[model samples]
Target: MIEIHAKTSAANTGSASDRLHTLGLALPDLRGNPYYVHHRTVDSSIYISGQLPYQDGRLLGQGIVGRDVELETARELARHAALNALAAAVQAVGELDRVRIVQMLVFVASTPDFGEQSNVANAASDLLIEVLGENGRHARTAIGVAGLPLNSPVEIQMVCTAV
Candidate 1:
């Protein structure tokens, strides 16, 4: 059982959606959110909005990455934010396997001295590939910010190709 970094990756078969389930994970319910729509489709492209690390309606890692929050915690938050972005992709495309990730942008709210933004973003990158395989691989940018909405520590956005 080669862990996917954070308590997953025991099996390596099936579609990305199936692999998601095999890893004991489920996409969040983005049914009727009043904040903002998760994604929009233009032609064959899905433009996903920035997603924060919210699990079961509770925000996680609400602090600076290098100050109050540790590196591993921030990385896990990035992974969860990416998962949320994946959910947005599915919502727009109707199926996870039907689309391919094109690009990703990760935001980390951290201290000015922190320099591991890419390392934190790697958690998202690693999980995407672990679940979606080649289709999940994508061009990415990781940036450190002084602050984010709701004081969350990490956020992620994705662009996917659909239909």
Candidate 2:
């Protein structure tokens, strides 16, 4: 795992793995055509839109939160969400090292009584910290929604700092 210092700098002197270990996370695969671009902004922020679970032109899994999907499934879906976010980051910055995650908002589709949103959100957080080190740590919010696009169990969106 890479360790990253919180010092705001563009050069990635820290190991990506160190950052992952710091957050107890792993790098997720960049799959699907999921990504985002920064709007015209003078600040160093990149707005990554919501990412859903998808691959090979198909949604990975979809259903009610406590129905066909379990908590672990939600976690995995969260990883995919981060993977897509990374793709967006790389597309914007040309490299992961030039990017730092600033914030994440996760949406989970669940029943009114099913409440394990934070557990699933951590999967994305861990992956981000692993891939971007200290830059990955950011403010986050996880909420349960009645539904997501294509009935997906989870959707994750992010904001990032880019050089």
Candidate 3:
């Protein structure tokens, strides 16, 4: 069984955005431009649009995880989707340090026989924790679905408190 690491109470080393850069990950372009936006703010909260594991107009991997896709590959896709979500949050609030993750909703495309949804979802959860430390700890929901947009293996959405 894959082990899910507990959240760490590490010192605030740097902004979440900087941590992402240190990890050698880049956020994709926002879905909308100057007019429409991929994220929106209401009061002190920011709502990020669901993001797929797509980069440079290409889906990272497709098909059901544990069947057509390997568990590791699907986990990577989840991380990618999380990066997109972080990018949207940054774009909305101008910096990752200004936002505190409140909730995360992860949707996974899986074969009927696949039952390790939490393990797949951990990729995103772990990334956020690694980047934001304590602030990364948030309510999460991992759901297995029959399919996803573009048949991508994972999609992620987030809600944050913009400070």
Candidate 4:
């Protein structure tokens, strides 16, 4: 179960973190250690490494977003990637409430005919907004790609301000 932080009211009417928990989503464990770090911070800004739709170290969806993977599935994977990004941000800053999402770059693996990158990205955007309220709003770019690492359907990376 995901833990709802106390500072989520300004992001939504209810708690965004609580919404996430009710959706049955859980943040992935950050694989950072002394040797390798998943996120880095400079001043109050935290840069989260690219996150895939992974849980328990396994990539969730495989194949191209508009081909082998359906749009809905890709969207769901995007949500997972968003969760992973949030996990990284929270891990780096020590609290979810301290995170103010600044930007998100979403990449979707797609076929030549696919053109719904924005719709797919909305899955992540909506989730972030629901979880963090105003702090979750951020500039975003959605790009369709030929492929992605680990054959995953989507990948996401983010920048956040830790207050």
Worst 10 residues of 4 by lDDT: 1-10
RMSD of each: 3.2, 5.7, 2.9, 5.1
TM-score of every prediction relative to native: 0.90, 0.76, 0.88, 0.87
For all candidates in order, the CA lDDT equals 0.86, 0.73, 0.83, 0.85
For residues 31-101, write the lDDT of model 3, one tens digit per residue.
56575567889988899888888787677888999789999999999999998888888888787787678
What residue runs in model 1 are displaced by over 4 Å at the alpha carbon? 1-12
Clashes of each: 0, 10, 0, 2
TM-score of 4: 0.87
List residue ranges in candidate 2 displaced over 4 A.
1-42
Residues 1-163, model 1: lDDT tens digits: 2555333333236777788887689999755579778998888888999999988888976888899899999999998999889988988888988768899999999999999999999889888888887777789999999999999999998899974
Question: Poorest 10 consecutive residues of model 2 by lDDT?
Answer: 2-11
Q: Model 4: per-residue lDDT, tens digit, 1-163?
A: 1322333443466555666676677677866547657788998889988899988977887999777999999999999999999999988878777789999999999998899999999889888977787789899999999999889889999999986
| Best of the candidates, TM-score | 1
Candidate 4 accuracy as lDDT: 0.85
Candidate 3 overall Cα lDDT vs. reference? 0.83
TM-score of candidate 3 to 2 decimals: 0.88
After superposing candidate 4, which stretches have Cα over 4 Å from the reference?
Answer: 1-11, 14-16, 33-36
C-alpha lDDT of residue 130 in model 2: 52
